[model samples]
Target chain A: MIRRSVAVAAAKLTGGLSRRLGFGGGTALPGLVAERIDPEIVSDMAAQLGRGSVLVTGTNGKTTTARLLRGILRSSGLSPVANSAGSNMMRGIAAALAESATWTGDIRQRDRRIGVFEVDEATLPQAVSALRPRAIVFTNLFRDQLDRYGEVEYVGGIWRETIDGLDAKVTVILNADDPSLAALGRRAGLRTLFFGLEDESLAIEKLEHAADARWCSICGRELSYSAIYYGHLGHWRCEGCDTSRPGVEVGITSIETFPEALSLTVSLPNDQTAQFKLPLSGLYNAYNALAAAAAASALGATNHDIERGLRHASATFGRQERLTIEGRDVEVILAKNPAGLNEVLRTITNNGRSENIVFFLNDDIADGRDISWIWDVDFELLSGSLKNVTVSGIRAWDMALRLKYAGFDTFDRVELDTERALRKALTETPEGEPLIVVPTYTAMLDVREMLARWAGKKAFWQED
Target chain B: MAKKLRVAHLYPKLMNIYGDRGNILCLKRRCEERGLDFELDELSVGEKLKSDHYDLIFIGGAQDVDQRRVAGDLREVKGDALREAVENGVVVLAVCGGYQLMGRYYRTAEGAELPGVGLLDMWTIHPGEADKRFIGNIVVEWNGGTLVGFENHGGRTYLGDGARPLGKVVYGFGNNGEDAGEGAARAGVFGTYLHGSLLPKNPKFADHVIQAALSRRYEGIELDEIDDRVEEAAHAAAVQLAMGRSII
Candidate 1:
């Protein structure tokens, strides 16, 4: 009783001060609230809503899909409290809730009809238990952290178990391009809708190192791939079972890669193809957009609204988020895993320039603490023709070794001195070619801070 | 265009994780500098691996499943041909899982034991008795010289009495064993879990492996004088780590 009163007082104080300060929920507020009240207080707080919420979860494209859905919901006459700050954890969701709430812990009734949430896979079971979402959108499952997440199959098993007990009213959205995720729709019946790519141009002729989709999940037959987009996400089928990348209701009709942006033509369920241009590179974003459209369609959003909202949506922080660093247009790509890195490498090389490339590999605790994934990335793709490769970060030498083995020739071996490498890599950039810096999570933070120090206020400008 | 080296890359597509191809590129470029041949043959499963014609026999690391799939294929090649090639002399260097498989047997975490090539007189046990997280820099002294690389693996391997130890453990868990089982060198087969890419930065080790192969093939094979720049760079990198300074 005393703890409840204290938490209420704290919430009120924080809510009152948020108007003066820019932020509302501090890092420790969620723990404070959980200790004071029942852990289910937030769910109880959300129960007052007339329409249940939509939950989106995935390993790679969660933020992109969530942002797209958020915009679509807003355009369709609904306001959503999404964790737009890129915080996808429990505390982040709590912060989003606190932002949406009043001093008395009530969601503002007049704000909107629905709330779309992008959730981390590890936190999904807890979040689903707390906030019984009316619908759940699972993008795809890939090998993320073997140290944290045993494997993709383990995560897939957990998701199957989670969805089995849900009520008949629950709607499920899955990516058919993913073998593990597409398998979820098989047993789901009418509640599930699988969305994926149909374009042949995204297909990989041969399997790369991180090929996890070798066999069919259902029949255990050898899987055949007509086209591989990235990792195992592609057009695949089991010869024994009729399993394949299910025909998506919404799909990317065409994708034209520009020197700077990706032009996509998406065919919607309403018999109209909406041409959407994202200021980012890669088909992964196209998948993200398709997922958002599918999630929005479940919530009664129209095709026109989805298109407008997608145009309004932009790339999330550090996931191909671009910035101007000391007059050079730099793209901060988070290559945490092999799939993500392969996409980054493919996108950058599409421009066909042998230019200055800076790759930072920091195997910090938060960054999976396993640098073994670097071997899986096709460094061979970057080795032969690329000009002026600069390696930096804690595992800089390690990366250098990998690059050398991949058949790349470097002028010098730059150590983990990020500041020096950044300066040299940027300053010595060939007259016309661009300098692309691919960094891991922590390295991204460090590079951003370094850029902020270098360029002052301009470094911390609007990301979109 | 200049004739690219006729370098036969044994396992280009598979048997790699951690930039193992970097080692190939390093060797190819060094060969290219002197106008040597370069040709990469991607020997995948179901493909015959005739190591007779190749100047270099390069094999890389693979996951447990991949190792199992490739094991039978590797076993098909008469060990006598490889042994004769090494005896007659062919440069062979293996890394990580590849290094483990070259020995007698490899046991995975799931308690499944797989047969190794018996190339090296050793065996590897997966999910090493201790944590395999070998981050940062490490040093190993081999043949009165120091080689630098990073060590990261979960398998603890015990050396058989007949096998020769590659180097002493200067840092990290050398081979996840008590005495820091850094590497094993027997005949022409060189095995090490260390991936300093084992070449560009450490040229001496690269030359040594190549020399060991060349000396067997030719009665008086003369190694071209190697520039000391590669060893100088590796030494400088190691010294910085030893002094606790960033060399970047």
Candidate 2:
């Protein structure tokens, strides 16, 4: 325990040094420290706390769920040791653990009640093996990192294999709407909790083929969907296996969409339900909240605490996080894939206001140099109410052209000069309306930096 | 009325990444500049590939699973339609997984092997899954012309004995084979793993394919000139970066 604490502290020092040197790299320094010392230093530090651990992993919604779970745990009056900086890797987790550990290489027992860590999907199997988290929350899996992970089914198979190897005591919370994830719950001896949206009103009439899970995992039959919430995730069933979305233990009933304030009704594990209002938008966020709630219930959090956390929690960076600058409101939403962007488009259109939107696309190394994914995004979801959209970033024109091809009017289309685009988009926004800025990975970082500078808040992610 | 070059984009609805449609646009713009007519026939499944009507046939790459799904349908294609077209001097270009599918067979380590359309004798073999993700500009020397683009594929391809090499490998595993850089027949079909919509980075290669298609119709015909602004500083930077040469 003492050695583990020392290693975490050292990792923290490494992260601090990297930040002090203005190096934005996330895993390089703490990786070195973890390598030199105990390789499982991060997990060991968390284990030393005597508190159970819950890990959340997925392509999207991981960051949002992590933030929600942290708030709920804090509201429950438990000193929760979490990766507050949004760092999910071994070194990042070590740095996070180092922040809470005492100098004597021991977690302060009084300060440690539970730990929640959001892990990268690619690294989940390794981290879960070492951490042996008490519960794991999976939001949904999509076709992300095609160059690295191949396809979504390939990732689904890996997740199943990883979960199968876990100890029988571990609980798994899954999104029942996802065919790939919900199928995992069918296996025996696995303690699984299913959470999803039962609200049929949020479903789209037609399924978008950009990257959807249209086939059933069990029977190899094509899934028949009554409606689609996002790509492939909705009320679906397989005729061959007779498998479908089971009765949701926890469900997102209603989402009251408000500017900077959204509310939802969640069915708690205790049979009683709680209505919580959040300052976030879109149905995807409702799923994020349900995942956090399900994991919190697994962690023994009370309904009251979950309610408070949902209402009191501020938005994390880029997940419908609202930033105010010069009396204009900018809703910074991260749209990495087609499903995410489609949801953003739906949420903005649901507002029924003609507002200027800033769409940022960066074909950076992390953003998948193949920007062809833009063709799959349902930009057609934006109807006549949507005002001019200012495209910006590396592939801004590419995005604009995609929108144009989708039958969107190009009259309001503007080239994406990042600085000028942001300024012009924000300034052109009519008063009393929110401006939506959709950005991919690197573009999200750039917009987050811009917001952080204006809002006078330091970026809390673990990168450096 | 001058006849427009009839082009059929085969298998576009699938196996297109890196915005492969950008290639179609590049071709369209080039043709428009030279006052040459261009009509695109998007022939997906259930659509026939009429060899006599079209001048150029272009196919893009698909994922391994999609490749398997499309393989059976592609085998049903009238080989004579394509082979005859090629025999009579029709232009054909396939990129990435499309290039692999045009060959004999693509075998994966998972024990799954799908038969290729036999447009090319070469075959692709997946030797234990590996992520050969090579980003940024890629340069390849081919037939006195330099082809540059980006490549990200898992399977390595081996060239058949009768095939001619595309170019010398500047970087990455060229075609995944020991000797050949890519699969290219100087006078006929052109196949490579390069993508950034291949032609945008090097218009000369696209032009070669177009000229070959037009030569059969209009002997000694002079196509209109295209002024590619990208051939300026931006492209020079990309070329420098693709080569081992530093821009700084």
Comparing chain B with the reference, what is the TM-score for each candidate?
Answer: 0.84, 0.90
DockQ of 2: 0.20
Interface C-alpha root-mean-square deviation of candidate 1: 4.9
**Relative to the unseen true structure, what is the Cα RMSD of model 2?**
4.7
Candidate 2 has what TM-score?
Answer: 0.83
Q: Encode model 2's per-residue lDDT on A303-387: one tens digit a residue.
A: 8888887666644324436666777667777777767777777777877633678888876667776565665666767756667
Model 1 lDDT at residue A192? 79
RMSD of each: 5.3, 4.7
lDDT of 1 by residue, B1-248 (tens): 54333334554544665457657766766666655556777776556655466555778865555667667666775344555555545767888778887789988777788788887889888774344444445677777877776555667777898797788876656766578768888777788877645665677787676556545534454456645453455456553564353334
Model 1: CAPRI class: incorrect
Q: Report clashes for each candidate as comma-separated counts.
A: 21, 3
